[model samples]
Target: MAKFRLLPDEQLARSPFKQLWREFSRQHSAIAGLLIFSLFFLLVLLSAVLTPHDPYLQNDSLLLLPPSWSQQGLVQYPFGTDDLGRDLFSRLLVGARYTFGIAMITVMGALVMGLLLGTLAGMTKGLKSSVLNHLLDLALTIPSLLLAIIIVAILGPGLQNTTWAIMLALLPQFVHGIRNAIAEQLNQDYVIAYRLDGANNWQVFSRIILPNIWEKLTLMATMALSTATLDIAALGFLGLGAQAPTAEWGAMIADSLDLIYIAPVSVAIPGLLIFLAVLSVNLVGDGLRNAAKKRREN
Candidate 1:
């Protein structure tokens, strides 16, 4: 039989996140994904400073220059110039900022809001928990992407609006998952012991329930981040995300549609980056999921 093994406070205090990371290190694909994402994140952080040309700097004279390896390419523009003569390499780098930044913002916002409501729902008994659970279930009945689209459509377009829409869409998942996890925690021996000892609900919840569920919450966060990024890309592709002139991957793809035949790199570059970003994050999330499963099985 599997047993609950809550470690002593002294051991738990000494690097919990590091312990989670150690479990992650055991998975090969997860490690590869972490490396890939770390590299990509570092590149995004350095995009503005490392790239030679300004993302917004454009000229008609250098329009549609192919990548430098091609015979028609210019030596100065490594990833070539777009139809508007903007440096594709610079724009690609800059696009990462908007893509990654928006996803992070949305995920964090949703997580915080979800944690509050979910915690409240999980901690309460009888009618309150039932009501919150029903509402969450109703919300979850709507497909995430479709829900996001509906919210974005109602709120109108643009990046911030799109982000808020995505955030709203993610809230139900967090509420459902966290509520269940906390409910499970509430039934555990440690929680019962705390209650017997006259520990208040807030005391047991804050000191015990939240810490034990941190691993699950982290997994949810990574998965939500990937979803947020992909949703942003989808919305941007539809012209409902970041507006024109902004270097966002989805917006870049939209801008490149007209030049698809003439300069395929325009579309391909952004698409590939989006694919890689989504893939890496998904891999990392999968690793976290597996680790959680292993912990349970033991």
Candidate 2:
């Protein structure tokens, strides 16, 4: 009998997660983005406990105070006070909960709904699929923010309404992307083999289709998350999202517009937070897409 030899660790197959990480780790910007995003997520989780003062509490005497080290600043307020004299640091910490939290929820909701609808459109025949494609095209032609604004205008402005509006506006992009991906995959040789091998639509989709298209789906998710974050901020800035006393970053910026010359830090801080959040998400998405492309080429 021939002797069998064990394969070396380097020659062994790595799990998908490990493989993706191996690819992703090579990108320095992705790692930095992940770190920044984690920091924002941590702030969201710890907002209630980490806040130095009640985000909503007002101190008329402390209005427009600068950062703690500034001549007019107080030790109790590290980032300073807003026009309402509320602790800027505290409100920003709490604001992460509203801004990032809402975007996360909206993206997830859109993803799930889009996946279902896209699958339906992809697996169906001529007329139904054509109709869906047409509808999706119409939705896509309208800018997401514009679509969201239209929805919010009809629903009446509020945080909850904003979330719903963003989710709906985002739905078309996810649906369109996923539908195209599935359509492309369906034309592959392996997909035909699966069909010939008696695999049902559900089985093919859940197994081969999903596994092959997962990278695309992930890229779409990250992009959607960034879009949702920006859309929420825009709506809030327009006074149509988070209402008064909400501590949302967009609303905070809007609230501080009048103080731009007098207490610019108040507006700048929130604007910076929004910029950082969007930038980090986009960086991670770009990194993932690059890594996935590399993996494919290899």
Candidate 3:
């Protein structure tokens, strides 16, 4: 009798979810990131119900207090107050909701826009492909942030415009990634096999090529989500994102800049939250990329 195990081909053909989970779980930093992100996002969701004070409430008499532990700080406003006495703690929590929510919406918009454009270009050949490729190449000449700023300027500054601008700016990269991924899949043996087996274009693409390229799409989506967060924050800081009265991390940071000396925590808290949000997204992206890589290597 001989002991037997599945060969690489058999293993690769097995259900992907278990393998993906196994690879993803191997990354300790990613697990830590998931926990951190969950905690913060939960705070964002629960902030409205849990806040001790209204984030927008202003009390001139209690303005610019430091953290409660600090000498001049008040106990009730544990996290402190800004130049205008808005609750730093409450605003920070609410800002998380606004910032993450906006980023998600922007990423989803970009995903759909990119996929359509990329698939159209990638699936075509000759003149049509050349035209679309040239268009995307021309669009890529300018940096995304610069393009976003220009778009915001043209569209007029506000949350909706800023979101659209960020999505538009991020679309090029996603399109490029998707186009290249599909182009590569089109050359692979599986696709050729399906084509030769009397499978129509739709059947081959929808059944084989799209499924194979899904991992790349997932990676692009995560990267797009993180990029959207940064772009939104940048726009907010420049006064082009969410308007005043909206609780957003970058906007909060801008409002608190003048009080950095009097109460640095006001600036620091929002800044840290933004940083953490980006970090968590990147960590998860890294885990997914690594997992995908591991599968490919195996």
Candidate 4:
């Protein structure tokens, strides 16, 4: 029988994931952001059960009610009702599904497509790479939000259309960032050594380049998620996404603009949610960037 001996704590090697976690946990803002994101994610998962009232159900008598804590407010309408008498709390809860959900879907799609396209562009040279690079550069010159708007304009407004528009708008940036990162890695001496040692393109990319660029990819994905969330909300605000009767945050804000004076809380709550969502994701990204930088330095 073979006997295995456990290494002492000082001699034990931590896994890369563990090392990354250790670094990530040290950042206070990142932890806070992670907590907030977890809460939002939970809300997205449980909105149907968590909401006290149907988000789309209208109650004429309950129109524009203030928050429950207010003297005139009803306990049943906590967080109050919107101008259309829809429960603000319920709508906001469900809105997470639309906002975070769409953002997630778009980012994921963009990330996958970007990776394949970027890897292809990075691995190739001469006219093929140049053409791809120039196209991405042209796309980059157009602001992502503006590009989304143009796409949405042509595709017509709605949630599904909005998702495709945002994904398309985001694809170029993702491709550009990933391509640049891969190109940088390919230029390193280690890559040259690998090639000289008979490592093929797929082997070099899969075994070396992919591992090295993961941190950058993660950071890019986080940042892109924030942008996607904001863009979705912006499109909703402009009446180009989500549409009516949906409990989306931006549409909720748009529906209540007329009552900003009568029920400022209605507008403020959804806007606050959007702000927090964007802020939390950004804080987490910043934390990741800092952690990765420190990890690299060490």
Instruction: Give the best candidate by TM-score.
Output: 2
Ranking by TM-score: 2, 4, 3, 1
Specify the highest-lDDT model's number.
Answer: 2
Mark the regions of model 1 whose C-alpha exceeds 4 Å error after superposition. 1-19, 296-298
Off by more than 4 A, model 3: 1-13
**Weakest lDDT window of 10 consecutive positions for candidate 4:** 8-17
**Poorest stretch of ten by lDDT in candidate 1:** 9-18
Compose the digit string of candidate 2's lDDT tens values, residues 1-298.
9997756434423566565777898999999999999998898788999998999999999888899988878898999998878999999999999999899999999999999999988889889889988999889999999999999999999999999999999999999989999999999999999999999999999998999888999999999999999999999999999999999999999999998999888899899999999999998998899888877675
RMSD of 3: 2.8
What's the distance in Å from true for residue 293, model 1? 3.0
Error of 3 at 96 (Å): 1.1
Query: Each prediction's TM-score against the native?
Result: 0.91, 0.95, 0.91, 0.94
Tens digit of per-residue lDDT, candidate 4, span 234-267: 9999999999988888988888888899999988
What are the per-model C-alpha RMSD values against the true structure? 4.8, 1.7, 2.8, 2.2
lDDT agreement with native, every candidate:
0.89, 0.91, 0.85, 0.90
Number of backbone-clashing residue pairs for each candidate, in the order shown: 0, 0, 0, 0
